[model samples]
Target: MDTVLKINNLYVGLKDMTIVKDFSLDIHKREIIGIVGESGCGKSTMLKSIVGLSDNNVSIQKGKIDFHGVSLRSMDQNQLRSIRGNKISFIFQKPDYTFDPVMKVKSQFFETVKFHTDGKANKKDCYKRSRELLEQLHFEAPDEVLESYPFELSGGMNQRIAVAMSMINEPELILADEPTSALDVSVQSQVVRTLMELRDKTGVAILMVSHNINVIASMADMVGVMYGGRMVEYGDAREVLQKSRHPYTKALLDAVPAMSQTMPESIEGAPPRFSEILQGCPFRERCPFSENKCETEPAIQGDASHWWLCHKQ
Candidate 1:
């Protein structure tokens, strides 16, 4: 209902290749925004920039990232350290690979809690909460789970624990990058339901990033269809899915499997690679609706809510 974050012309580049530029977004309180795109379209990179983590003093170079009316551009490590993990949390794609083989589950979990929390929560309380979270996510044997190393747990268990860690913080916003991409079909629904319930109960505005159209179609309040590094279509979920504007969006929606219809064509050509120079439209090669203007610089412009850069739109 109200804007909690605003990203204006946000630009991020590693070396000379621009991963994301002129990227803007508005996130409101109590809302979920699904970011959908092909792999290597810079979706994860953008989310990583938003999370803004650093292993010491080194941080990614980024433009405007306004959170709760405060610009994050000038904020130092100490200033940013206060906001991250507590205000915004991330659920990475691969859960099993995210943990350390050497560290016990309890050790890693405690460190995560201590990092985000204002003061150290008692070990007993942390353990109690950890157990509650594990059970909440349908895991069994609380004591065994905590004592076991991440290597000892299965993929599903690690995923459940990764989600559990995020829940421990009660963050205002959650960025889930392909949260269910690696799971089996049976487990996929369970993961989706967990996210849905989390949003419903906590009112945490979620940014669910995935390449699966069907996965996000039912869960999100708003869907942001991304192409290359830019947002191609953004609107209410039903509207964007059923009535998308950009050609890329239409193509993606068409490919979604449905019982009644024949399968649609997968988009032609591969997604573009970002190089040293700032290029024109990133989706030019794959877009059937590409025009002469596509080869030139394009500004991200449209209505306040729904936006696109394509001339045809």
Candidate 2:
């Protein structure tokens, strides 16, 4: 499989505080890499840095962000703009905020296609493409959706539209930041199924960041568990989810609600604060099996296919 996006030893920060530390991952063509972590774990920050959309206060301090063997971090604004919504697209958490309240759905789609094509694409052709994508996304009445305003549709409809728009350009990779987190249970399932089907049909790679482990378990080809702005464990989705080694990863999976009567186990202590530089394992404070060696930085353990940073293993 061809690698779509690569991040090596990435470090992102807000002024003096490093929020994303030594983060790295390779997303292959048509692969889904799901990153699961609690809030403030730098999942969104990492996604923003990949697209060069990090806030004014946040910046990539060091590391490489390569797309198709090309350096994305080295690209200037003009260069990045050409790839932003064309070769690479972003699906934000809030679909309502992504579109203009006043603009009709079809018009918004046209603007996206036109902006990426430098206003060379015909409106009629763009409409045809949009309708096709909406249909694939399971929109029964694609034409009605195109004619309606964003506010007129439900959150689920808007999110599906967001997914459709992201695929309209046929991007190589889609950086989805909590795409289904904002929707209810039923809608979440719909959006997840649509995205999975979209991947099957288009072969577009995806880097999805979410707090929901169950969602990740159902769709991701690879799973990455992050804490304190660092990847604590990563491996095949089944291996990481079922036979996870890292304490943090285990805690996360245990916390997920199941059908059994027993309550889910919760991890003690909160996630580490980035303002202060953390030494040793970030989860050492909360890990039940912590040893004296855990006071210092833990060495990388496990095989190439499945690995983690911990002293226990």
Report, for every candidate in turn, its global Cα lDDT versus the true structure.
Answer: 0.76, 0.92
Candidate 2 segments exceeding 4 Å error: 259-261
Return the lDDT, model 1, position 197. 78
User: What's every prediction's RMSD, in angstroms?
Assistant: 2.9, 1.2
How well is each residue in 56-134 modelled by candidate 2, as lDDT tens digits? 8999999999999999999998899889788999999999767999999999999999988888989999999999999
Candidate 2 clashes: the total is 0
lDDT tens per residue, model 1, 104-210: 88777777778766656677888888888777777768789999998888776778778878777778888888988998867777788777777777788888889
lDDT of 2: 0.92
TM for candidate 2 is: 0.98
Q: Please give the range of 10 consecutive residues that has the lowest summed lDDT in model 2.
A: 258-267
Tell me the RMSD of model 2 versus the true structure. Answer: 1.2
Candidate 1, lDDT over the whole model: 0.76
